[model samples]
Target: MVSTALQDLFGGKAAEAVLLALFHHGEAYGRSIARDFAVSLDSVQRQLDRFERSGTLVCKRQGRTLVYTWNSKSRLASRLRDLTGVVYDGLDPQTKEQLFAERRQPRAKDKPVIRR
Candidate 1:
C-alpha cells in the first residue's frame, strides 16, 4: 500500500486512498476503491461523497453502481492530478507497482495453472 503522506496532505486516509485510486485507475465505484485499499466501504463511500460535494469529483449511475471520476472542468482537478502523478513517481518501486497494477483482465473458467 502507498504511504500515509496523502492522508497528511489531504487530512483523511480514506479520502486520500479514494483519490489515489480514482486518479490512477479512472472511473471506479466506492466498493472497488475500498477493496483495492482493503479499507472500510463506508469510509470510502463517505470520502466519495465529500469529493463530489467539493467538486473534486463527479459521479453518475452506471447500472446499479455509482461511478466516480475526476471533474476535468473543476479548476483543482488538473492540479490534483499532477500532484498525484508526482506522488506516484516518488513512491518506492514496490508500492508504485502495486498502485498501478492491472487487475481487470478476463480469466478463463476451470483453467489450470502451469508451474515453471
Candidate 2:
C-alpha cells in the first residue's frame, strides 16, 4: 500500500494515518480519525499525544471532544504537509476514495433510486 510507504517513512502507521487525516480534513478528533482509518482508538490517541507534545500539532477542546490540527507555527509543518500531500496523491484510486468517503448526511427516507 502507498500508505505503508508513508508509515515506514514516518515511523508508525498510526502517526501516518493521523497526519494524513489532518492534512486532508484540516482538523479532527482522535476517535473520528481512528474510525476513518479503521485503526484502534488507543493507537490514534497515542500518536495524537505524541504529535501534540512534539509541537507538530495543537489541540483545542470543543465541547466534549479535543480537536487536533497541524501547528502552523512549527517549522516543520509546511514541509510535512507537502510530503504528505505527495504521498496522498500517489495513493491508489480506491484507497483515495475511501479516505474521503465519510458521510455528511443521511439519505432521505423512502426516497426513490435514480439511475443514469
CA shift at 89, candidate 1, in angstroms?
A: 1.3
Per residue, candidate 2 scores C-alpha lDDT tens digits across 40-78 of 999999999998998889999999999998899998877
Name the TM-score of candidate 2.
0.82
Instruction: Give the true-structure RMSD of model 2.
Output: 5.4
Candidate 1: stretches off by over 4 Å: 100-102, 105-116
* Model 1: residue 86 alpha-carbon error in angstroms: 1.1
lDDT of each: 0.76, 0.79
The candidate that achieves the highest TM-score relative to the unseen native structure: 2
For each candidate, C-alpha RMSD in Å? Answer: 5.7, 5.4
1-116: candidate 1 lDDT, tens digit per residue: 65666788878769778877876667789988887787899999988898899888999999999999999899887788788767655666666456555564454664322111
Question: What are the TM-scores, per candidate, against the unseen true structure?
Answer: 0.81, 0.82
Clashing pairs in 2: none
